[model samples]
Target: MTPNDPIDKGDLLNVIKWAIIGIVAIAIVLAAMAGFGQLNVNNVITLLTILAIALPIYYFVMMLRSSKVTKVERSRVKAYIPLFFAAAIFWGIEESGSVVLALFAEQRTVLHIGSWHFAAANFQSLNPLFIMILTPVFVWLWEHWKKQPSAPGKFSAGLVFAGLSYMWMALPGMLFGTSGRVSPFWLVGSWFIVEIAEMLISPIGLSITTKLAPNAFRSQMMSMWFMADATGQAINAQIVKFYSTDTEVQYFLAIGLVSVVFGIIMFILVKKINTLMEGIH
Candidate 1:
């Protein structure tokens, strides 16, 4: 349609509704923060971060409910909803590589290997390093494995692996005690495991997002894929506050188990979720 074409009344009204909601939400957050003396740079950044994640998700839901979305498209979008949340949870753990995990590397682990000292920050490189190493291996495996899992199945497994990565972190604190530094290998092992989870979820998630997208909202669905990452990081900002040297083991176990339990539930409901997919697989 040309720019000169009149905007539909319903569309204009919907846009206005969202604009008003956003303004009020921001105002409320700011007022609450100011009241508590928490209206600072970091807290404001967190608020913006959550908004960035939430808006796209809200938009995606609205898109699915649009009159242009067909019955089958609506069903597929319904199936996509579970996957989106699964992705968000998976990412919350995976993205913590730079935040919670970084803190572990810096504060908990011994940053030396037999007198060859290194920077704790160096541990961050393990994420991309492992991704490069694992991507090709997974690319080959997916081609040769004949009976690969569906996207939902892969996402479930990814969550388990991501959970295990945190569970691995809990062990060093559990065995060695959190007051003293443990081996840096603990961080190494955790990064390795989470990267394996990424191999399952990241690429497959991108491909599946494309497949599951309703025709009218194709590009918007891809944005929804990225919003999962934002949502996870936004959650990370709040949850990371709970992660300290004092609460090391409990924090790791709590978040880890949540992902694992959700994953197991998803696995049990795989058949039901697939049915909702309406043969997209």
Candidate 2:
């Protein structure tokens, strides 16, 4: 397909529809596997390894098929460097915190809910439940706010709320002492906070990429965003490995500190970046 192919709103809608379908399909498969006792940790690891092998092959095919590949000018891309780094930091800390929470907080404690032994890992899904309930309210409020002159500032305020989510874990660490039994609610609460931060940053980042990338290379630019995420995941694995020796309090504190700092930096830069983006658009 040529870069100048007419942009169809329907195509975008279809892509989104298919993506949701794929997610539901995968979820169903995973649920079935879990029910069948085939979705253990080893199986999940093996599936990830397979995808790791497959991703490069898919990228190579895309590279081969496209002829309009013009190098994205470093000067242009460099303007987004701060946002990219912020994104990487956010992703890395969120991922690493999940590992630390699971390993130190969740695994160390077990809840016997009647006849079932509920692993702390299962509680991690609570964030999705919260998102399902809160997303519509958030969207409605966002739309209403957008009608006001000060909407951007109001929107950026969400970042502060997101940053405060880290304190949920921090306060508990201080109170109960990180080594002792703690409620699983903290992880869910932290996830809910980060989810808000995610709502603020991620869509804006994608919109920025859509605007900043050269028209011909927009798909490649979006792919690079995913690659950045993969890079963060690799770095997260390293962080988890390196900090394995540290106490739960130490790891959570470090991750929370990084997140809070990154959130503040991003919030400070958002207005400037918004102006720069206006110039580009």
Please tell me which predicted candidate would have the highest lDDT against the true structure. 1
Estimated TM-score for each candidate: 0.88, 0.63
Evaluate residue 237 in candidate 1 and report its C-alpha lDDT on the 0 to 100 scale.
Answer: 82
The residue pairs found clashing in candidate 2 are none
lDDT of 1 at 77: 88
Task: Give each prediction's root-mean-square deviation over alpha carbons.
Answer: 3.3, 10.1
Model 2 agreement with the true structure over 216-252: per-residue lDDT tens digits: 5567667756654565565566556545423555665
Per-residue lDDT tens digits for candidate 1, residues 148-223, read: 8998999999999999999989998889888999988888999999999999899988998988887777778888
Backbone clash pairs for candidate 1 read: none
